[model samples]
Target: THSGTSLGGGDDLGAYFGLGTATGVDRLEVRWPSGLVQVLEAVAVDQRLTVVESGLLAELRPLTWPIEIGSAGGSFAYRLGVTNLTEASVEVDVWLHIEGPKGVSITRGPIRRQLGAGSSLGLTGSQNVPGGAPSGAYTMTLKVGTFPIAEQTASFSFSKRRGTGRAEGGGCRPGLGRKL
Candidate 1:
């Protein structure tokens, strides 16, 4: 995270909220080069996995994907913006996972069927990147999973034309172009 523009890493990796009071709270032990020592504890306790705490003033900054794939009254066109200064409201379960190209999958569930409270829901949805999903860089996990109590994890990953006639750069090139 050193050269990632900003975010120093703590407040348990939300990096700090409202941006203050996280001074030198370190926990280091990721050694390698042949010394070997990392049984676990980067950050994940895993009890069926749940970590609910997010009045987190801000962190998911992605604006204007602006619905780039729309047809047939529009099904899901990928317009995920984010901002919730927190009063109370967040039910984000956007999980559409499809992997192929030696990593297989034809479906994965839950893409914002419903969510409301405290606002900020530009999370449009879509799936079926499966033209035999095996070309390259195919790992889409919009898996917010009610994440951090839904205060964050307005997840990301775009480019859903999944090329075969080979048109992988921007948009509109896979056949059947259905309802968004």
Candidate 2:
């Protein structure tokens, strides 16, 4: 049986089975949403185990390391690879999360795509840094399906840029701002 929740409510995302005094499961079968069926033998009982979809791979590749952010803010780009190694085509949903300093977080789409059998798809995109984001370390997490497949961390630092200053009064005067 599957779990369901009402609107504005939450529920546990786990499946429970009553073994009825059975010692362990001899076989376990899972039918995934992608039309892929997986079978496990000799499964243990009374323990939590993560089941990752077979023949699907997700990878995160950052174009730059230790991203630098200026006072005016900046943007970072990355490449994501999703491969289907099975004999049949499957549909996948990709999600991204970037967690920054001071509990700042950014979430990106469940970008849905269909991949042919034994083929790979590349997704490239950039994310803008909020102007008020603090300079510190950040982590980007990639999730394929319900599993987090990859994670990468980078540092963000503020760089000083020159700006023109205005005169105290309305007079025509030009001055340079303070250098960092």
Cα error, candidate 1, residue 37 (Å): 30
The digit string of per-residue lDDT tens for model 1 on 31-139 reads 3333332212133322232333443222222234532321111122343343343566654554334443564654444444333445554434333343343444333
Off by over 4 Å in 1: 1-52, 56-77, 81-85, 88-117, 121-134, 140-151, 154-164, 168-180
* Model 1 TM-score, all chains together: 0.23
Worst 10 residues of 2 by lDDT: 171-180
Q: What overall lDDT goes with each candidate model? A: 0.35, 0.57
Go through the candidates in order and give the clash count of each: 3, 0
Q: What is the TM-score of each candidate against the true structure?
A: 0.23, 0.53
**Which candidate number would show the highest lDDT if scored against the true structure?**
2
